[model samples]
Target: MATPLSAERLLTALRDEGLTVHEYREWRTHNRNAKGPWGPVHGVMVHHTVTSGTEASVRLCYEGHSTLPGPLCHGVIDKAGEVHLVGHGRANHAGGGDGDVLAAVIAERELPPDNDADTDGNPHFYGFECVNLGDGQDPWPAAQLLAVERAAAALCRAHGWNHRSVIGHLEWQPGKIDPRGFTMDAMRDRVRKRLGVPPDGGGGAPEFEPFPGAAFFAPGRSSPIVTAMGHRLVAEDCGRYQVGPGPEWTSVDQESYAAWQRKLGFTGDDADGIPGETSWTRLKVPKS
Candidate 1:
């Protein structure tokens, strides 16, 4: 329902959301705009490149293979969580998709099942091709996943759209299953939380709450900081709490924090739920 963002705006939005972006060769001027319309964008579309390694994938996307043409997508999200801009307006990604799904996306509501493909998504969506095996076995490292979230959130925020505006290629195409390792729903939840940003662009209205150290989370603790954290966890769809994330430090808080840790790609003892300085810093909890 809006015009496409300028290349400058695209870069600014992404950087504003805290992503490390790499400008590929001729990315600013590269596009398939000559082939069709490329405005009135409705949302963002996600995909997997079904390839391994960053440099090759980015190159392939920038210079697409035979039968697909070149500049296959606007950006290639590498496994390292770096966003490599390959092309600008109207890249070759987001081929035809379900019209019903497109309508739902325009309405910013729950998407209908994509059983038909009578729509040209190329003109209406911004495509991101993420490097992966698409085999479900390839790991989605925490950094990579977080980059996807930030990248998508950046666009949605700029457009004033919500998490609903982001959709997986699988959700748009019939018999397609890209972005396989993580559920779109979960990813949307992460985007929603990150998008909870106010005019200040998150980190609270002014700044994020400081990490209070592990000792501060001892049982029976009561503070608004704990409550703010709980809300953030819930927004991330990681709430393992039985009820309220009240101002008390209950096991519920630990369980929820663990879920967040796991979502960030931590595992085993590292995902043990307790907050570490590194993870805490990344969480960016709003000041109480």
Candidate 2:
């Protein structure tokens, strides 16, 4: 499909959405060629500058930090909800995430785990970094969350994607926190509701499953037991993984489970690859 809107067109569209627009001095060229199809854009990734002022956040994203190089995102949303376009094509945000999740977003299916930055996310996702502390203590101003929701909704509408396409920086990165305070799931929930998708993980009945204390896992249609287990782990601070307790499990989950094998001391490799048994034993779970 053709590009939804040119930078100029996007600026106009954003303005129509009631957001103030600012064009950064050092942004990606509007006509720059992209690596892949701009259509089928699965979703939008929300981020926090983790910096104080909008100017500083803009400069950092435009110039990039020492660790990330430069041009870290496509747009920067300020405290007042003004959106500043930084880069257009492949703006360097979105490292690796689970391919399954990417596909699910594209298909408008329920999302799975975001495993790695292995794929070229920049080509497929529009990135936005909002100016906020993301320290969890910093309350998400009503304006900021509104801006995020609007921005995400606009992008999803343009791309024909549902709110499930919306996610957070923390959701993509393991051992890293971002856009804190508000949960990624919660943010997506608002988006989903707005888009008219069933907020309860789509039309599929939620499966309750146990998640091993692993680095990541993805749940699919199955017993609510497995779904409940995975949900518990995510709630208790487990990274998102795209393994359904039934099948399509990856080696990573196995590694994650084996690493914590000793946590289930008496258990054997039974917990090594499965998302149950020993791995579940290691988890400090609350009664449901």
Candidate 3:
């Protein structure tokens, strides 16, 4: 069992981990503690907002709908890698979840599937709502994902817990998947690495494919990789397609790639629209 960190300590821990944190209005005092207990904390829970635009998402999370009440989460991690502190204690993020899952988190052991929702997760977990559409195609920028890893690792470090103490919303609830673009296991690997622990020891290494190279985007290529790249391009707001960045590469893809190149300050022949090793690597497009 772990005790909840004070607001000051939590803020300090996040900052010490190199996160860009923004304190919202009355965030230190905002919470739903009246609804339930907020002690004996177990772990950190990560979730996606399933919304867009940093400002709007932050507001929505800070001030939830009437049905849900405000302070939907303790923090809102924006696309730019900034953490907006919306509330401190007992935020309305994690709902009922499997007690067994919570037990696994406390033990720093591998989790069983969350088949039941009989536990009060809101009181036991610190929650972060990351900005994302939650659709598999929404695209998780590397910065945002890194922020997630750092934030979770920060909490785990403070609590003297391992990466197994971190879990996605999908891992807790019966049928919910807010973070769809990336796998929780891979995220855990990152946190484990940050914690100086071998990533494949307890739960084994995640099987996510490595990022494909620029050659994978060559003309006549019609794999799901192209579609994944297009999704990433669209997420970066560099897509130039009027119809589709479909499986096959077209002039539009070249045009879009050129725009991305220009965005990265490439000029002359360098901005000829084809993906290069550098730009493609920077994009960090998720492997299909």
Candidate 4:
């Protein structure tokens, strides 16, 4: 088995991975955490450009969008999955989120719901921005997906964290959505699978102890599920925890479940699993 990649070692690996590397001194820091460990990092966060090409996305990540001053992420991964380091140490990526979620992620505990963007995730997460349209229709090439998996798995190996720690940008923010079609849960699954971890035994997303309303919980029924799912799935290393069968729940009748859920309008979280609305819906189904 290979060793995990640290932030410093990650640089060498990216260089070795055949990607042009650039260091932005204008966006570097030491990240003083009064309440956390300074090493053995937790996990990786994946995102989509929502911009067009690789170069453009890279420039945007370094330059930042109008809403966010600049230096939006730590790295920009191209459509080919080649990583380009942008900023390091507290880059302006993950904003506010559930503190329990962050704590669980750091401890590698089962994730909890990210009800709001109230925490500073950038301080803890290693962000990666991949080139994609973010339109939910962009085709995720195997090469790009593989690159993401490699990068994430390498980090997991380094930090002693399972692939479950990895998440997506959309999962962190409330009204924001990037890294669309490729759900965080799906991404984590690939990373774990690559690391020789059995898909089932690995951690699942944190439980939303007190689930929201029926409409809020049901797939296609509310917007919160996607955001909520993104939060839980990434921490648990599952894909968006949507209501029915989807890419996230591969152990079950995946194809049929996804088909049914999509028809109901749930893109990420509103699908099935154990308890809660998704489970209720699935439980209601007649056993084959």
Identify the leading candidate in terms of TM-score.
3
What's the CA error at residue 125 for candidate 4, in Å?
0.5
Worst 10 residues of 3 by lDDT: 203-212
Model 1: per-residue Cα lDDT over 1-288, one tens digit each: 665777866886788689999999999999888999987899899999999999999999999988987688888898889999999888888898999999888887788899998999999998999999999999998999999999998887656567788999999999899889999988987887787644322222224778899899998899998987875676455777666768999898999999989878999999988899888876667665
Best by lDDT: 1
lDDT (C-alpha) at residue 188 in model 2: 78
Q: Write the per-residue lDDT of candidate 4 for residues 60-130, one digit (tens) a residue.
A: 88878677744677777777767777765555667676667777766655566667767767567777878
| Regions of model 2 farther than 4 Å from truth | 1-4, 26-40, 196-200, 203-288
Native-vs-model 1 lDDT?
A: 0.84
Instruction: For each candidate in the order shown, give its overall lDDT on alpha carbons.
Output: 0.84, 0.61, 0.83, 0.58
Ranking by TM-score: 3, 1, 2, 4
The digit string of per-residue lDDT tens for model 2 on 1-288 reads: 113345654554466457777899856474223444444355788888888788989888888866775578888888787888887666667776667767776665666666665566666677899888877676677887877887886665444456667777666655457777788777877766655555454622112224433444443323334433433333222324554322334454345444445434536655444555445644423222
Error of 2 at 187 (Å): 1.8
Q: What is the lDDT of residue 76 in candidate 3?
A: 93
Q: Which RMSD values do the candidates have, in order?
A: 15.6, 16.6, 16.7, 17.5
Question: Sorted on lDDT, highest at the top, how do the candidates line up?
Answer: 1, 3, 2, 4
Q: Which pairs clash (backbone N, Cα, C closer than 3 Å) in model 3? A: 258-273
**TM-score of each model, in listed order:** 0.69, 0.62, 0.70, 0.59
> Model 3 residue 18 lDDT?
99
* Residue-level lDDT tens digits of model 3 in 43-94: 8999999899999999999999979998999999999899999998888899
Which portions of model 3 show Cα errors greater than 4 Å?
203-288
TM-score for candidate 1, residues paired by index? 0.69
